[model samples]
Target: MIVPSSLFASGTESWRGDGRTDEFDSVATASRALADGGVTAVTGAFGFDPSGTAALIAPERFARGTRSGASRPLPAVVSSALTPSDVHTDRIRRVLAAIDEGVVDKAVLARTLEMTFDGPLDPADVFARFLPGPDAATTTAFAVPLDPAPGRADHWLIGASPELLIAKTGRTVTCHPFAGTTPRGVDAESDRRAVAALRASDKDLREHAFVVEQIVDVLAPLCRELDVPDRPQIESTPAVWHLATPIRGVLTDESITALDLAALTSPTPAVCGTPRAAAARLIDEVEGSRDFYAGAVGWCDAAGDGRWMVSIRCLELDAAGTGVTTWAGGGIVAGSDPAAEVAETEAKFRTVLGALGVDPADLTDRSRPAPAPTST
Candidate 1:
């Protein structure tokens, strides 16, 4: 986890195993149960759907220090879209129509890409590629083993996320939510123009407002004093520029844990939308199960201090390690252009796609025929 002052990396030496919450119902209940059972720290992932299952564990021992693996050269891999480009854009158009009818103010639409390698892929190696230099502090890189579903094998959820869902230490809490997006420009002048355009975009600003408003609504009652900036600043990753607001507050109740805050604030307009339930229903009708793709991942300790990050720019590695599925998404508002939304998701995918040695331009090339859908 990346905190304001230090970076923490941990490896499990022994697993309590019993701490797994097969079906995550309530973060408060599950966390209380773990703490009652003497688990010092509970770590794992929460599925995207609030009612879906979660993979959490209590580690008996944690080995910490510098990250210990060298990134291996990724082998040639086959790539295919789980959700085709045309289908995704069509979904966006449908959402635009819904917005017109006032069914929902905004919704987030997502798509996935599957990459199968020639040989076994190492989760550590792939994760290594996500880490920046030692001094880099903004991105949080994670690799958590997921508890397999009834018929599925063990897998790992790995990513380098730029958004923090929530964090807590003592009575202090903070969140940095990102919404508006634009791809980074190739040249210095173009990059500056891109950032300026995003700042002035009415559509993008509207989309970002929904996210910040929702977050404040959720946090206000729980906070003794909240600080929300009037404007969003630009946050940059290697491939995209995001409109981000850094929110900080002092909790009214020290009893509120990080996981509790995460559960309450997540699925914010950043990933789901305003009137969250309506948007979620629309997503369900169109996108189907998100699994843990846009879920929250991180850890909570017995002291109720911890951090959780939104699971974007992430991938799930299959048990055999030969295949990985990664996802990207964009928030859809009334004025959204279908084609531009498609391009937005492509730009979001560049984080993991570039790390995998795939040129992101391949995703945007219209001359190339779309790959056939593949079974995960």
Candidate 2:
């Protein structure tokens, strides 16, 4: 349960609720209880075996990540080890077919394919290889474990995402945007150039625009005149630099709680897509799934305002605590290159691998090359 803001220390971040909640102590039981009690929404790890208990979850409580935000909504979770046949996968298959039929040129879809090593995965060993050093204040980047359910085994959701999803203080709301991804280079100069390229990229700019626009559109009716900027700026670090945009607005009315706002905006275009209705249809045709991969995966208070990020860089645990899945994808516009898009997925996978301490280089079977570090 969320501790009231009054319980926490006050400051510029006073809007932050008291940081009193603990990591979910019993994932499986809590998940099950939510399921049985008819909880409206639940989200945890991103790699639960869709064929297992995770798939049985109701849409709200058992929602997926990446889809947690608007601009990044991929219909399915993405990973290397997942099997390709399920209801979500089937939906993606339909979406892909439609794209093939001249419906949508670019539909973002993902998978959470998992792998088991001889040992437990560790993020410390690998995160530095990709991300290197502590970069920003209030910035967190790592491979975190997702408890499949309360009391279940730990599952890995990997990635180097360094953006805040949402934060609230009373009636005020704050959001961060992470789009326009670029890979780091072997040399410092080249790395800088890569980041520069991302900042100046038309495709990236458009992708960023789509999300920023959507946020303003969705919140205008509900918020007290948003403070979103006209253009996103280049926010960078050694590993990755994004066109970070911060959105702040006050709740226009008090009838709804924070949870109500989350329901309306948690999966904005920043994590989903532009023209959401059409994008979802295209996803069904091109990618083929709608399990919990790209849905909301954060906690909430009765007031509803809580911090939730796009469920990027995460995994869901499977039954028997062995198998797993994870999701990753990128915005595909008219100029999107299939190969580069594949590379972006590879870059995202490193966050998971680094967290698991699994060497991405160890995999030779993947169709893509070993990923160079990129800002997640």
Candidate 3:
């Protein structure tokens, strides 16, 4: 077992898989092989966009299963943190225009902040120091390496995601998607008001329901029974509050694995949008490349059971660690505002920004250049 001790907190070694595939069936081939071997555990990541690829890995070295001393804090100085000013807003404006044109109902647009560190970064530390309080208990934190495929460098994807793409155990599956978002305020009263507003906001509710409905539509065909809540509950992280709904169902086909369920429901309305094909086209035309920003990441076992979380609030780091790119964004509907959407992206970047010792609030300045009309 080749365990790398200095980098990760767990000291585990995984064989990273490689390449992107055009179809979900290609991604499932690995998991099906593991299941045929009896009970086993495999883990890794895939991309956010449909045509993108995946890297599902099997662990060659395992953790010691022991706790260490108190975790260390992240670095305080940021060499540089930057985002494209008018570009982000312009992207959102175009998507909104599409919504008005009846091309799509909603689309989750994303923004990335690229940072150059003074030295190599330890992804494990990034995951550990982010949102380190009681409220973060529900979050799924990860730091894993991608396979060494052609044109793909040895990079690690790290972050804490609060949305569960899919989880399977026995013949049961669960999907919890979060859509509507409100930034948490510094004061308790302010925070409470924010939560209340999220629940009451018609736009937020509609955005949240689209995600729930998409998951139901995908799973209903494969499951014997399913349960979806009428309303979303407020799921809180240290930095933001979200409208989250947990959908549960029992798979009629025992042969169906967790990976299969994830493939079906991924790029859900929460991350992608409604009338998927239209939203995908808009994303391609407006947002450029998403890479793995909103993709699914986690593990599957030999028994066909596994867990995958929506890859949000994350960063991609080079193996050398000299650079990092953090990602965050939100759903854009008819009522979405350009400035408000910009602020929402900043809110989503809080966990990573905070860990990097940068004040996330600094990015919310509305004075940033306004987006020009699409004709420009």
Candidate 4:
């Protein structure tokens, strides 16, 4: 179930599933469910591949609100072990080769870490470490039930994502897509310099622009009035800083729900790459599969008004929550450096690593210096 920190105190019920809902039919179906005055949680996989899933689930019960604090600190030994493929720079070289061959202008490359903790694991505990009593407002923290069907192991998808895939409230809609990134510094001066470098870097700016342009192009036809900033603003999470642009518009057709917008704009250039189809093919050959890591996760109300965020900075826990797999990736454009990309994935891993009670340095130690910490 997706439990947003702010809504945790509001007695909001939630649900989850490993299935697909018709993007075209979901809004109307959800509107019917909401006619009775209850909200439903919609969880989707990154859905880059044809077999990915999505669902609109009803909450079984919404317990009275309570303030559950962070979980106990896990032992340091319960850290994620890097795999040979986790720091593999060769995959990036291949992606760059595709860029050189003009197969795609930009493609996002990702890596994974496998974590097995001692003793039983709790999804709430992991969530608490990342969210921390609702004070961590920079990012939206969530936990979605992974398997709601009977005869299945209980599972949940949890994460704290900084990007908003789509938001709908009546006729107005908003999207915040992040593209370029840089690691935050340990001090004020260093942090400022990191932000400046991201803004000034031609490569980063170009990457960021591609994402903004992609979102604008898709949304323009559906909106009566659209607004996009000329430049991106800096948005931060405890993990990294992003070059973000906030786009807003009044939907020309109120019939288009948030879910429809998500289907239309997902696997965006920010997460996929320019010329989405070609990038997806390359990602498949290189990264294999991404279950829900880059997918959309959030709740949609009965009225079809809801919020969904890109699935990043997250972990896919086993049904029992014992084994955890998390992903981190970066965009590859012309002039990209393979070694630097490896470092970028390492930096992105820090958010989930810290949440899981593992030291970031331990993971970073295995790779080349992590590119100052940027996120997908």
**Residue-wise C-alpha lDDT for candidate 1, range 1-376, written one tens digit per residue:** 3211112342321111222333323455467765575666667778776456676655544334366555568776755545677888878988989999999999999887877777787766777677654433456777777753333346888878888899999999999999999999999999999999999999999999999999999999999999999999998888899999999999999987888788888788999987998998888776777878888888777788888889889899888888888988999998898898888888888899877777655543233433333322
lDDT of 2 by residue, 280-347 (tens): 65555445554445543344443344554455665544433334456666666656665666566666
Pick by lDDT: which candidate is best?
A: 1
Which residue runs does candidate 1 get wrong by more than 4 Å?
1-29, 134-136, 148-152, 360-376
Q: lDDT per prediction? A: 0.77, 0.49, 0.72, 0.69
Q: What TM-score would candidate 3 get against the native?
A: 0.86
Residue-pair clashes per candidate = 0, 86, 2, 8
- C-alpha root-mean-square deviation, candidate 2: 10.4
TM-score of 1: 0.88
lDDT of 3 by residue, 1-376 (tens): 3543112222222222222221122355565666567324556677765345776555543232322322655443345444565788888888988999999999988876776666666755665554334445357666666643234466777877788899899988988889999999889999999999999999999999889888888989998999888889988887899999988899899787777677777789998998987887777677666767888887675667877888887788876776778778889999998898888887888888776667655443334432332310
Task: TM-score winner between 1 and 3, please give it.
Answer: 1
Name the 10 consecutive residues with the lowest summed lDDT in model 3: 5-14
lDDT of 2 at 283: 54
Residue-level lDDT of model 4, residues 1-376, one tens digit each, is 4433222211122233323322211334444445545444443333443234543355543233444557476644354555344335777788889999999999998877776666657777776665633444336666765553222246667777778888899999999999988888889999999888888988889999999998899999989999998999988776678899999999988866676677678888888998988888788777776656787766665566767778888887777556787889999999987777777777788888887767755543244322222212
Q: Which prediction has more favorable lDDT, 1 or 4? A: 1
How far out, in Å, is residue 372 in model 1?
13
TM-score of 4: 0.83
Q: Rank order by TM-score, top first?
A: 1, 3, 4, 2
